[model samples]
Target: MENEWKIDASESDVLIKSRRSLIDYMSGSKNNFKGHIAIQNNEVENASIEFSLKVNDKDSNSDLKLIDFFENDETPVIQFKSTSFQKVNKSINFLKGNLTIQNITKVVELDAEFIGYRDYNGTKNASFEIIGNINPKDFGLYYNSYSSHNGYAVGSDIKLIANLEFKNQ
Candidate 1:
């Protein structure tokens, strides 16, 4: 049997993390996103997800400097479209996908954990946790020379984390 699931945005959360220094870090989160999963015979056949973060959104916790760093005006959205899923175990999988930032697309792999399913209010729901790391420089999100010279350089790795819930459609 084939089944399709849509993200329950109200129950899902996405977060981003980055290091500003050896001991200092920054983090932000967003609740608004859209995604879907396709399953056949209890296995994920494919999936896709997309979300946008506003550099000036207070709730997003985006640093003011990011306004120019991310070029939010020209490219306001970040998106991910899964190309394949590789199962490593019963509960663990690697989701290979294309991640687009600032109109630049790069292939990335994310660790996905299937947290199983549940019956809630006569509906079937599923949960998952996805994590990935990306280098901001790869997408041209480099800090100015001044920041680097002053030892305020941001770490190359930015972690993307998601706790997602899906409801069967």
Candidate 2:
């Protein structure tokens, strides 16, 4: 329990956002996933996360994207493994990791901030907020449907935002 933390799925969230050419319609997914974080002496040492974004999930509004855009059947789970961690300020930090999506792995940087550790009902919890953006093309999601007066049907960049909580274990 000294150097390891278990993800509290009940208290965590993974949200992705992207827009389409039509100003009114936006494509995105709000997922609840599980993962772990390893720390030593208050410094991040390692981290790993795995999550399956099922199109049928209640929070998923883009079923067409799951089949045509991402092809979730071939690659069910999206994963990330941390390679390095850097502290930019007292609360802000950087996580360098490889994100594997649809069998394509790319190195990505995640901006993370420590939300402080506190004891809640006798349980010690550490929380963090991470944000980043990735190009869908990098992960083989290159399908594009252009509109006449507008731009491409879908945006190229997908923004990822996560709020995660881990319990000392």
TM-score of each: 0.71, 0.68
Cα displacement (Å) at residue 90, model 2: 1.1
Predictions in order: lDDT: 0.68, 0.65
Q: List where candidate 2 sits over 4 angstroms from the true fold.
A: 1-4, 19-68, 71-75, 118-122, 143-153
lDDT for 41 in candidate 2 is: 70
Cα-based RMSD of candidate 2: 5.2
Among these predicted structures, which one has the highest lDDT?
Answer: 1
Model 1 is weakest, by summed lDDT over 10 consecutive residues, at 22-31
Candidate 1 global TM-score: 0.71
Please list the residue runs of candidate 1 whose C-alpha ends up more than 4 Å from where it truly belongs after superposition: 20-32, 38-46, 62-68, 71-75, 118-124, 144-153
Q: Candidate 1, overall lDDT?
A: 0.68
Which digits, one per residue and each the tens of the lDDT, describe model 1 over residues 1-169? 8889998877776666556533111222343567887767777756676555443334433442444456436535567777777877666788888888777899999998877788778888888778998888888776563464454556568777777778899
